[model samples]
Target: MSGANKVQKREADAEPVPGLFTLVLHTHLPWLAHHGRWPVGEEWLYQSWSACYLPLVRVLRTLAAENRRHLITLGVTPVVAAQLDDPYCLQGMQHWLANWQLRAVEAATMRTASGASPASEPKALRQFGSREHTEAERELAEFDALWRHGASPALRELLDGEVIELLGGPLAHPFQPLLNPRLREFALREGLADAAHRFAHSPTGIWAPECAYSPGMEAGYADAGVSHFMVDGPSLHGDTALGRPVGDSGVVAFGRDLQVSYRVWSPKSGYPGHAAYRDFHTYDHATGLKPARVTGRAVPSEEKAPYDPARADAAVDVHVADFVETVRQRLSAESARIGRPAHVVAAFDTELFGHWWYEGPVWLERVLRALPAAGVRVGTLSDAIADGFVGSPVELPPSSWGSGKDWQVWSGEQVADLVQLNSEVVDTALSTVDKALARGGSLDAPTPRDFVADQILRETLLTVSSDWPFMVSKDSAADYARYRAHLHAHATREISAALASGRDDHAQRLAEGWNRADGLFGALDARRLPGR
Candidate 1:
């Protein structure tokens, strides 16, 4: 069938007896390059690149090649984009791809060594050449081939081709709901501009960090030229008939379909944890690498076996089919109930595809292909809004995809110290800005706009990221999280103090230090904010 006919047929099949379904995917990761390498930071970047970014780009490229017009919208935050385009990140990803190839070679060598002289080796070593071992070698080879090429061209191609509508968010994916209004406003505006400059496409929508929403955030979106943003279904009070405009701002808020999104990846349970998928934790102590099955229940670290991609691929296919069916059923049912087509938006963190859930890319490809086959149409959020679906009029409660779909994950008792620190530092920076501005250029040489901007940038970065306390609460690299929080906090505090003291040398030094550490948000100029 012709591609357009196929899409029309799918849309016809998905027409709810009565509502519309929209699918929005969020793509974000913090700036990890030049920070740390193997153990945690850079490894995060490399793994996600291997599993998600590269595969996603390939999927879009293939669809475009076939003239399929698979309309999918992706939100890539400025922090994530900065890292993707960073020289350090580019070089590190290349090294990471090369290292995977080396691992494949090593796995093959180990298998051959064990097979050539089985009796001469220890009894425990005989299993090294078993079927599972051979499968591991094959999977690594496949993985290496997929990522050996650089990711830039593929990423650029998607953006340039308009295969996917790009969405931008605040620098560092900050939880803007709780942030200082002026600072938040500055972050959002600059972030969108930065995205436009980098991707060569001005984004009309934003993926609010964490899908977190607040009443007045729409005003900020409007200021940034964003006409729409997304939130979870519950945030819209369980209605998805159409997007609701926030206040007088000409922006639409698209709520995510929690039910459908959870089918793919949820906080507590999802397809990624299936026994057949690759396990994220529990790597081999000898190689310091991940090599085991999810196995449903956690296995002892010592007993975990090498990763078997073949097994994982089987699981991906099954899950993909199930996911496609879920989408089909939801869309069909919603359309019938509403007496009009309704959108079923299934939103998720892009990192889940390749970084945490190793087989995510395979599932993504299968789902994209299956959706059309199952008579379900694909589209971007912009397409849905442009089509005239209006959301119900309801006051959205403040919420995020965090624990309990609330803000506690970022501000709970476990993270009270960090939260309080963030609050105080932000207040101090604001106060300093007020004082400096009030003095009318008489505050000891007057803090340079860049100096003030740097302080705002530092405080903004420190306050915006939901990562700090998330790490602490989960106890996953708590020390690193705490250290980063303090690093940003101290910079905020010191810069405020230096400005308050009217010390030029100290202010310059502090600004330079903060700039050197967390410098991705160069686009943020606090002076640009009204009355600054």
Candidate 2:
């Protein structure tokens, strides 16, 4: 075989290489279906589903069909999974996609009417509109044939093929570090069960929301049947090449290799900022489509250049090469430092690939295909754990992969009221439900499930989602976040009060009404709730 043929043969065959590389993508969104739209709501779900979920999953499926093993590990969080499987969301998403197609035609016909252009402005957007219409049509057809059932089957297909390892998280993505221990345990257990119910397989690994940890969380992990989880590199503080057991718990904590992860995304800089990539913030207001590239940090949205796929693809190639080199160098350096083959984990939010960074998916495909050829072994987190990529127990401080590297993001002074309010709501919901349960067996007592209690639990759990406080603290949609939190709190309080005051008819009405709006986790039987 020629030299080129020899390289191709190596890629077509799987064998151990110099060092291990794993990519972890945490997939999550707050319960958004039927919650709101436009500025932030179900639109969020459909947009991610179309742009991120569809393309990313297809990439993995294609690779798996080629018999590639251990592509990546994914955390399809419970709240997100609920929305993905909800019938209302599936119907709503299809409608949104069809509308997207129609809107493209409208944009092409009415560029002057489309806010992105003026009568005097060149109709450069016709091309963008045409491209989007094609994308919309493709997604809509694919969705009809494959995704009508939900995201579960798509993900399970990958899991069954061993293309990915599935990691699940709590029902609401709560900040477990500061949450009540019993509630935290319940949420994790229920979250795992939710995944098993939807996908027909329980995840042995978990992507703890925000990769947050508080010393004894590993004990909770061991109890919950989680064999391994992830934390940021800072949590390890010394060496991050190998996974470490937390204290005495047998469960392992893999530390993300920041050197590798930050090469792709960070607070101040990353590959997404490349001038040729599509700009996330800029949009054509009329059609709600983005047509600009990140020309520069100071460029205004209107002044930015229109997106060029060819240019963006060139940038993707450069970045993919850069990232692959970064991985190879890091693996080589870490192996030398540890005196053994090292595991380098590059973890990122799944949304970045196609939503926030337009070229991310393409870059990912090239990088993954290129890495093994560079003498680096690529595999999922589970593969690392099973291969004994673990070290001695390490004492970890209470930490979260958020600002300031502590619990400040979720329980900071900036959102002290939310913190206090969360405590109150959690306490009230638990106590009220417990009291109702205790009064059971009497003819007057509420039935074992009452399901109104389920609403109280569901709505209260939504109230405590970490997204609210994080959004509030960041002031990024603070008002909307506050509205959602308060909405759930009111539902919990109203239903609890009705049940307490012996207004069974009124409580049933409220529960049924709320159930239509926020009914997720059909498997969540509130009678089994394990808290005060």
Candidate 3:
């Protein structure tokens, strides 16, 4: 039989694959809008935006035009959405793209100015600057046409078309397990509200920050109106064949199938680590370009081979086929073992695709298109729930997607100081605000919140972000993380002191100063937020 006929035959012969397959991509970044550029701040945002978000949007739009639905489940945290829609960040991204093109042009000119021939230079190195220049130009055009105002319109288009299922999360991406109940609820409520404000539709599910779970979070999710959430597979005893209901809340927990997800990325062994793919760690400091491949382990940079896109494309094709078959066989096995339909949820960071893997977007586009032809039923988490992926009740343990599948990364001995610092700021902010609200009699009804109280809450939430401790423990951008944590903690302390000292003027000034830079949730009304 021909290829198309074989697909048709498989569709007829297979027992509907017994379930569904969904890929979940979590999009997040700490507030970096005004947090400096170069080396590691706003640059991180623009690079990812251009390299990942823009291209992914294009890929989805192409699929959407074909009426393809539920292509992926995308979770954009409120903090990330805030930055994308911020006027300042949007404008800065445009200039950054233009600068990229300019640098590429400079790279070409320098090549011509040099006395050496193209034969003397590595082909990839010789072409890297020009490739970047062209990419930058294309990105700028796309930005002007689609993202000039912000990412809201582009995102809303995808959501409305059902090309993507939107999953919202808490403000600042806080480590909810350690947060006070009052603040946790507030963040969830406000975070969903922020998504609604941006996309005109609230998400039914959330990609919980780090997938960190305490015992009673399901109740909080139910209260916040979340119908489902994604957690690491081990959270459900390594049995992730379905979205299991937690307690009696009607909220479902979908465990990521590590067997499938790790195929795309893992600490050791994955598609990106293949020698044919681009090496993310190597960079051209002069041009800010990457022009090498993962030649091998312990290979010096000078000896590393230049990146060849043709070779990478070939590798992508092979990996895409391998991944599809892996999912197919896994689903078939799970269905036979369980005597029912089985669902597989594969989740990963959004930046891993284009930013880290370079050819990730291409592989994703190909895989999404190929899975259906291979007899796999692809759908979103909601579609799965609607189609009966909800299974038996399961009690979840305290778990995270981090190393060891526990909270050690955020709460371990290495990060004890950060954990203590987070606790201190959270307590101070809650106490100061609760007392002030009681004194003003606002605890009983809607009343105007003071600027100091508002700033304190914002600082406390920012200070408690999980990124700080993770960065500190991993030693990646540790200094910046440390600086940011203490910066917010100090702000909370100063604001709380001003509120306690009865210096309203100084408090207002401090709030205003902080608001100028540290403000993210511009519409977060502190008075209306619920407290325990």
Please report the candidate that would top lDDT against the real structure.
3
Worst 10 residues of 1 by lDDT: 111-120
**Pairs in steric clash, model 2:** none
The best-first sequence of candidates by lDDT reads 3, 2, 1
Judging by TM-score against the true structure, name the best candidate. Answer: 2
Candidate 1 stretches greater than 4 Å from native = 1-21, 111-156, 247-250, 298-301, 304-307, 434-452
Shift of residue 17 alpha carbon in model 3, Å? 2.8
Query: What pairs collide in candidate 3?
Result: none
lDDT of 1: 0.70
Error of 2 at 146 (Å): 1.1
1-532: candidate 1 lDDT, tens digit per residue? 9865665566566533323455567887666665677577888887776667776776676677766563588888888777776666766777676666555444334432232222213232333224334544443454455433433345556767767788888777777777778778767877888887776678888898888877777766776788988887787777765678776676888888877888877777889888877677765333334556676565654555445567778888888888877877787777777777777888888888777887777777667766766666677788788777765445668887777878887878999898788778777877776776566455467534656655655555755487877888889888888877787777777777877888857887878776675666666666665454
TM-score of 1: 0.85
lDDT digits (tens) for residues 107-149 of candidate 3:
6555432212221144445676667778888888899999988
TM-score for each predicted model, relative to the true structure: 0.85, 0.95, 0.94
**TM-score for candidate 3, residues paired by index:** 0.94
Error of 2 at 308 (Å): 0.9
What's the C-alpha lDDT at position 425 in model 2?
Answer: 89
Q: Residue 52 lDDT in model 1? A: 78
